[model samples]
Target: MDWMHEHELRRVNQIKLSLPSSGEEALAARERIQKRIAARRAARTPAAA
Candidate 1:
């Protein structure tokens, strides 16, 4: 519904507004994201013989 789309847009805008603005905060965010990606990749990849 149109209301759902509008609600999601507002949520996305709020998230954008809350994002870290400092370099250190940005670096910490990047590290957390990388760790999550690595964990997901490790889970999906088959073990070597």
Candidate 2:
């Protein structure tokens, strides 16, 4: 809902740049952020389950 559309979430989820270079940069940044989030999520999951 509204919480999911927050600025930080929008920024991480979408690449809304005007130039190609800018878009690439945003994509790279988003990837890095996503990797970190994924790593954290994985670490939180229990291995036995």
Candidate 3:
């Protein structure tokens, strides 16, 4: 989880630096990263009995 968070942070930073003019673009990037991370976590967890 720590690694995943770090990776997401890195991606966010990259997006921020690459396009410093658009807040909306940054927000969209963050949302996409978050959804991907959430989906990965959900897939890794065991199903309830």
Candidate 4:
């Protein structure tokens, strides 16, 4: 079980390391997603309120 966990962790780390986005691109994507999520939440709240 421990070995399986270690293998999975290594695989995940490798994939993360290999991803194409530079730090700025990742941050920009995250910010865009957060803004979209916040806008959706705001839209839902007033209707429910």
Best by lDDT: 4
lDDT of 1 by residue, 1-49 (tens): 3667887989988998788768879899999999999998898786641
Cα-based lDDT at residue 30, candidate 1: 93
**lDDT at 25 for candidate 4?**
88
* Candidate 2, poorest ten consecutive residues by summed lDDT: 11-20
Q: Highest TM-score, which number?
A: 4
TM-score of each model, paired residue for residue: 0.49, 0.51, 0.50, 0.55
Off by over 4 Å in 4: 1-21
Candidate 4 TM-score versus the reference: 0.55
Full ranking by TM-score: 4, 2, 3, 1
What's the lDDT for residue 32 in model 3? 100
Candidate 3, lDDT over the whole model: 0.82
* Model 3 residue-pair collision total: 0
Model 1 misplacement above 4 A: 1-21, 47-49
Count of clashes in candidate 1: 0
Worst 10 residues of 3 by lDDT: 40-49
Per-candidate Cα RMSD to the true structure, in Å, reads 10.4, 14.6, 16.0, 8.8
lDDT of 4 by residue, 1-49 (tens): 3666887989988998888769878999999999999999999999999
Comparing 1 and 2 by TM-score, which wins? 2
Give the per-residue lDDT digits (tens) of candidate 3, residues 1-49. Answer: 4566887989988987887567877888999999999998888786632
Error of 3 at 29 (Å): 0.3
